[model samples]
Target: MLKLFFRHKWGPALLILLLAALVFFYNLGDISLWDPDEPRGAVIAHEMLQRGDWIHLSYNGHPVTDNPALVKPPLYYWSIALFSALQGHVDEFSARLPSALAGITTAILVFFLGARIFGTKTGFLGGLIFISNHMLFEQARSAEIDMTLTFLITAALFLFYHCYHEHYRPGWLYPAYAALGLAVLAKGPVGVIVPLMIAFLYLLARRDLKAIGKIKLPAGLLIILAVASPWFILEGRAFGAEFFFRQNFERFFHAFDHIQPWYYYFVKLPIHFLPWTLLLPAAVAYWFRRRKEKNPGRTFLLIWFIATFVFFSLSQSKRSLYIVPLYPALSLLVAEALERISSEQNLASLLPWIRGGAAFFALLLVTAGGTAAWLAATRFHDLARPVALLVAAALAGAALLYRMIRKGEGRGIVTAFLVCAFGLELLMAGVVYPSIDVKSRSS
Candidate 1:
């Protein structure tokens, strides 16, 4: 079964999506809605279904306010409501279904986009990395709008990239524009703003400024207006301009909450990105050494990462999840690096760092398991069985990965890392979250 993935082009894609589905949909409804965001979204969708009012946003039976619950556009609320309606009721599962679907779609998108730019193997690895991304794992299982927004942004970027490369007819631009428009509905102007900025920068970098003319800016704007304006206009008429200013403009310039130092992502991103994060520096260096080559794929990915990172870093309101859309670009780059190393490309110097990274993560996982074991022994006695099982799994994975790294087996190393990631996510879904739920209820 595993051999088929290496032997066939389509096998990896199928396997990746299946793995993503298992990780994402497993025990999705077991936990209660998390505080603030989850319950807020579920309850609002419930109310919207009851009131049959989709346009105007509200929470807890009150008119929408500038609070986090009512700050964004209604697309996510509409999604939850739609899913709930189909499911006959809104629970954790129904509330989070949209995000799970989006997460899965995003995983496949990463795979296809990577395959488009790199190759099938790199694409498969990239998709595997994305599915195991800690942020994606958490958000996909929750009722947050970030995953859905990330999906829209990723789709918009991927479609626009295809349009730019003429991989599709000019007609492709329309759906790309529609995606941008829907993204606006998902969040706000930033949804449209970020992608357009990245696209413009990419064109400018390529010195193909004339390509901008082909984008049909005027018609595209109209499409965006047609798709995103109805709810904003209706809501504006009902609530005036206050919500718009506060939610969009004010939040960016002078965020009332979640304000962080400019360098917040500098620290946060590396942590959330995990074992793959260590590979990023090597991937970047490899790309830099090859900068003289005119690789549009590499250029566009670098721009996507830089533009998204700088854009969010500059914003006053920042959360780690705000950069979820950037993970695909990162994953593709890391996958390219891994692929090159496996093929013995000019990235020989990077091999040591890659091995070191695997070893480091193996040690980290072992350490984490030990910590959990300690806590189980000295503190949470009730969680001893699951904790011990997790610890054993962690140790076994760590030992296997370390062996792969020592043997200098590039493909084995990647496979082992992914297998460990899958195991960790399984443990997380099967044990950790449920344990947290139990503790939350007990407390």
Candidate 2:
């Protein structure tokens, strides 16, 4: 069983998703939903199902469009509604299951794209890094649109990458078109806009900006309009063109919600990337140090990462999850860097950076564990010992891994490090989450 799990083609992906599920759904229903976003979304789906009006969405019998803050499109809500049917009710588990699956499938797509462009090893490493991304893990379990949007956008971008290079396969653009439409439905125009921007910049850098023409623009646009237009058309007739302005444009340009400084992502990205953040210095040095190199896949990812960073940095409304859409590209870049470093002889020179990343992670694990216990002490004091024990186990695991790296076990370094990451993530999901949930309720 162990050998087959290791050697089978699709087996690793299932194992990785299984890890993600442990981190996502272990205590999914043990805690109540986060206010405003989670409860609001769950309630909206429940109300929509009760009303049997798929086209129109209502929260507590009120039109979601009536509330500017709640102005999300139908794709996420509809998904939650449909999935909630299994239990004949709406709640965290069912409402959030699609998001969890989307996160899993997004990792699989990363594997395919990476394998197509790089090699199987790079693809597998990249997929592992993505699924273990701290922010992705957090969002995967939550009932929200960001993971769903990130999945759709990543899918569209992956399709475009293939369609651009293999123009003979114009057929790929059809599903890419469908993904873009779903992206728009998932978030808004920005969903479509981010992909378009990425494609434009990537091609421009390649001196083949006209490759967009090969995407079967007429058919692609028709497909997008066909898939995306029906909902908007129904929405327009039901509510007028106000859906466009209120959701997309106003959120982009106006000063109403989630306003943050231009450097918001710059500040938040490190936290979002977490364990992968260690490879960042090497990733940047690898990319820009050989900037003019003709590695199409790496170049595309660099452009995607930079473009996403700058684009979201400049947005008037900035949230950490806005950059969540960019994490796959970031993960691939880190994987590429690690892969490159591993193949080099003097990997010892990079040890300082690796140790630095390890130190940061140790601090994070220690802090997360301590914080969870401290906070829970006031309300759920009984939960504190278990939380402290979990943190100790994580720290012990991390120490053993770091000791191996220090003792020249380079091969196990990456594997050992990733195990610690997985352990910390699982610890958070399984043990610490209930404490945090308790704290959130009190405050």
Q: Cα RMSDs of all predictions?
A: 1.8, 2.6
Model 1 gets an lDDT of 0.85
What TM-scores do the predictions have? 0.96, 0.92
Whole-structure CA lDDT of model 2: 0.78
Residues 1-443, candidate 1, lDDT per residue (tens digit)? 55555666677778777998999999999988988788888988999999999977778778776454366778888999998999788899999899999999999999989988987878888999888867778888889888888898899889889888874467878887898888888888888999999999999999989888888878888999999988788887544365567766887899988999999999999888876786666677677777798889888988999999999999999999899889888888888878887777566777777787788889898999999999999999999888988999999999998899879867788888888888889899998889989998999
Question: Ten consecutive residues with minimal summed lDDT in candidate 1?
Answer: 236-245
> Which residues of candidate 1, in runs, are more than 4 Å off?
1-9, 66-69, 238-240
Give Cα-based local distance difference scores for all models. Answer: 0.85, 0.78
Q: After superposition, how far is residue 238 of candidate 1 from its true place, in Å?
A: 5.7
Q: lDDT tens string, model 2, 1-443?
A: 64455454477666666766677667777778877688888898898888889888887788877776777788988998888987899887887888888988888888878777777667778888998878988888888899999999899899889877885488877998899988888887888888889988988988986777777878987888888889877876544456577555776788578999888888899877877786577666666656777899988888888998898887798889888888889888888777766666655466556556666666666676667667667666767666677868766876766676576543456676678877777777766777777767777
